[model samples]
Target: MVDTGSANRRDDRTPVLAVAGIGKSYAEGKQRRTVLADIGFEVARGECVALVGQSGSGKSTLLNLLAGIDKPDTGDVEIMGRSIAAMGEPELTLLRREHIGFIYQFFNLIPTLTVAENLALPLELNRIPSAVRRQRIGDWLAKVGLDGREGAFPDELSGGEQQRVAIARAIIHEPALVLADEPTGNLDGRTGNVVLQLLAHLFRDQGRTLILVTHSRAVSEVADRILALDNGRLTHDTEALSW
Candidate 1:
């Protein structure tokens, strides 16, 4: 039997992710425009949090800060109790490679690589043995319902199939956190729902933490908590408001 108990096994004292007083800005012309300001929150291990905002609301910027892909002008992002601000480039790269997974709206699969090759990228980067990597690739392909299509390239698959491969690629390394940016934005309603269900199943069943950024209310509802961003500031936290 699968171990459902894994969900309850996390230590409640230390959150998987913490953000404090984060601020970011960009130079537009002569003046700087703020994208995010003083954003702070924490996501507990095994919890799924949705970040909701309208277009140009800085949701994507925040996700980048969380992933160490971009730096905040002020404040710190702590993942698994370590501050990302203190890490240099190499350390940050390693941190991302080891602890963070990302799913993008574009299904960012390499056009040249087959589905299995794309799935195998993370495992290879982390130096998982070739023998074990093959097993994991096989297992995840089956899990995502793309088992026999491993040889297919990205262009050969439908939108949903490509997304399934992306999801499998994101989680196959067992990263401590997953950040999804508009995961369903590129699909139709029915396909999006299927992807969401697949994500919910994999993350919840494995006791993984997810921070999903979306504009859709229906998509936000999938999370255990919702955080709403408005005009560069955090306007609502469902956990804080007890909604």
Candidate 2:
């Protein structure tokens, strides 16, 4: 059985995210299909939480809810102490740009933008000065082992290299939260393992809160807590984890 003992440790600080009683549904052929039901969880600052389940188990639905890409029919979602459920699209956009970062399974890098430009996009959107953005791009690219490839476009890089660019883009702005959806799903096992270890280490060292949705056991092993989703509900909130 999944343990709830750590749920009591939430008083550690204000959670980076607080999800309460969230539910989502869609209509199909005049029938309402529920995708998630009464889902609730809290991710504290600097914590890495993993959501694992079979395909069609609503893992992506939960990630969408957390990212504000979709809204729940019931319940509220608070991010960085702000209520996302009540925000209009414009406000939500601003909040996301300013405080949240996303890493996608497909690397989501703009094919037309060069590597350095891609990494600088977030900071540019935040209106940071060009000099600062340039410096950050240079430093992060080197850290990701892609130094001197700044002028290359996404199409010019291999899958692993593209993913490394995605990672650099996600954290360059130093957002308070990072949401990764099957981050390594596109790489071979060995390459995926290397990227996963890099991501886990970087997020921890930066003290960024992470909520990762993944099916890989290797990915799940890096989380500080593991929660399992079944059907439309959370079936497990495993015991506290360290490392």
Candidate 3:
């Protein structure tokens, strides 16, 4: 793996992510519609935060901003103490490649690539040595309980298995932060619970910080803290309030 050096120098007391006075809106012909208003939060190292919101409550938008996938109209988003809005496109791309990992609801594995290849993509991008990459691929496959399925394609696996591969892929590169969007939404209830349990265990064991966007109360309950969004506003939810 490429030695970014930043992680080693980071203080554990510093938050992995910080967002301040963030706001976003979209132009709708002659008018603009606000999606998020004055949104703000901090996620410390190894903390898992769940973002719960209604369909249009802007949970995805907030996540996009945090990932630097999209920019907010106002305020700032900082990851590892660097402002995302201050980075150029190339810098943002590099930031994402080196610092952020993403998990999607649909198990966004490449249909054409084998499981090993899929897991190796991030390591390859980060210029990890081929030997180490192979070892990590084997190791993560075992961690996610997908051993011996290295040559299998995405379509060949069950939903839970595919998601397990996705989870391993997201984390194998050892990113500082992980963004999960409805990670278990595509699976059956029993399978989803099992996957969730595995995800929580692996992340906690590795001490990786996570911000998950989920609609299910059961899913959100796994997080250390839950933040609720409604009508473009955010609130800390101790009760894990339902929409």
- Against the unseen true structure, what C-alpha lDDT does each candidate score? 0.92, 0.91, 0.92
Once fitted onto the true fold, the runs of candidate 3 whose alpha carbons sit more than 4 angstroms away are: 1-10, 237-243
Residue-level lDDT for 24 in candidate 2: 96
TM-score of each: 0.93, 0.93, 0.94
Q: Write candidate 3's Cα lDDT for 1-243 as tens digits.
A: 855576565566688999999999999999999999999888999988899988999999999999998999999999988888889999999999998999999988999999999999999999999999999999999999988999999999999999999999999999999999999999999999999999999999999999999999899988888999998899665533432
Model 1, range 135-223, lDDT digits (tens) per residue?
99999999999979989999999999999999999999999999999999999999999999999889998888999998887777778
Q: Could you give the C-alpha RMSD of every candidate to the true structure, in order shown?
A: 4.4, 6.1, 3.9
Candidate 3 Cα lDDT to native: 0.92
Q: Clashing residue pairs, candidate 1?
A: none
For every model shown, the clashing-pair count is 0, 0, 0
* Clash list (residue pairs), candidate 3: none
- Report the Cα lDDT for candidate 2: 0.91
Off by over 4 Å in 1: 1-12, 239-243
